[model samples]
Target: MIILYDISCTRHNTAWSPSTWKTRYVLNYKGLSYRTEWVEFADIEALSIKHGFAPSGKRADGSPRYTLPAIYDESTGAKIADSSLIADYLEATYLDTPSLYPHNTRALQAAYEAAVLAHLDAIHQFTAPYLMTKKYFTPKTEEYYRKFREPAFGGKRLEDLLPFGAERVKQWERLKNDIGKIAAWYDKNDRKGSFLLGETPSWADFVAASFLVWLRVIWGEESEEWKDLETWHNGRWKKLFAAVKKYEAMA
Candidate 1:
């Protein structure tokens, strides 16, 4: 059996967070059995140490990798580091079931799926700074949920993360606006149905939508607080959410 450590609550979204969702989705899609490992700041150190995921390169220099969505396959004693890599690895190893990335590379469909993967990756990186705020970050005073400077009022506190600070808040608002653009793109592109690929769920259907789930969390789901997002989510992304909910219940 393979081991999948879906690192949630890491305070950051970089570590294949949504990839974890998609990896799990593909696991179900392929009918492969695996276990999930969840984490927050208190336990992250222990989890990384136990699993040899201790930040080595830049992490040793006081900067952290801050990436999750780790995949450990004890069966072959191999650990996969990145999220998208995990997706490709799984599809290649398990050739028996419905192909996640179509086997036919000659066709434009396969090319298009690869393009979607790259596009989602680019989108996440391009928008990461805006997507999350200090809310997701743990406190600096303690191991988790720490606070830094006052929101934008104090300009002297550079070391501390200003939760409500001007820069962070501005970036957050910008993210909201940026997402509106993304939503426009979604409306223009995905007006067909829940799945990006129409009818059947594809890798894009599962993975791209996973980030969307996070975006909604930050924005709110069908709540008046973010009525625009809520309406869009309730109307369009409902099917993706439904798929995740249904798959989770299988256990």
Candidate 2:
């Protein structure tokens, strides 16, 4: 069986990391046999290094940066890191399963993933404050998260990053407009379908849905922000979320 390395959070009822969700969606969509090994934020580096998983990237100071959503495929003795690389490994190894990069659209799918991240950049600010709450993280993980994130915010407290009131409303409106821009991309799909490739699921769909899942998990499904999102862009996102629901299993 394959072992997927994911981040551990207080919310054990569901997986919440958007990056790991991409791999989880792929694993569940392909119907693969796997189990999750949840690691806390502070332990990711040590555990990854001990297990010989390669660094996913580098920090600003050029030190190796380790992250979760890595995998140890016992059958093949392959230790893979990074969600995209893990998807590629699974696609290549599991020939009998569904293809993530169908129609030889790997390059297009990569581009679409990049575009999604670029357009949703503001989401970090919108969701960062929630990470400090006990509802989402423990004191240890919250401290780790704070140290990892505060430098980027110029040492501001997470609560002050986007305080409630006019500034928050303006940011919310901006996020809505940005999501509308992504909706415009879906409109060009040639045929009406819940996925980017009209009626067929692909990695692009997972890339998009992972972010939606992140928003839903962080904001809570019944939160006013999520309710607003549900009706945006002619309910495009809500429909997409439904389309991907079948592949949301943690196993």
Q: What C-alpha lDDT does candidate 1 achieve relative to the native structure? A: 0.53
How badly does each model clash, as a count of residue pairs?
Answer: 12, 0
Score candidate 1 by TM-score against the native.
Answer: 0.59
Off by over 4 Å in 2: none
Residues 55-124, candidate 1: write the lDDT tens digits: 4234434565534566777776767755566667787787796676553532544454455444442233
Best by lDDT: 2
Which lDDT tens digits does candidate 2 get at residues 1-251? 99999888887756788999999999999999999998888889999999999999887778999998899999999999999999999999999999998899999999988888889767777787787753577788778877877877889888777656888888888888887878999988788789999888999999888888888988899998899899999899999999999999887
lDDT of each candidate versus the true structure: 0.53, 0.88
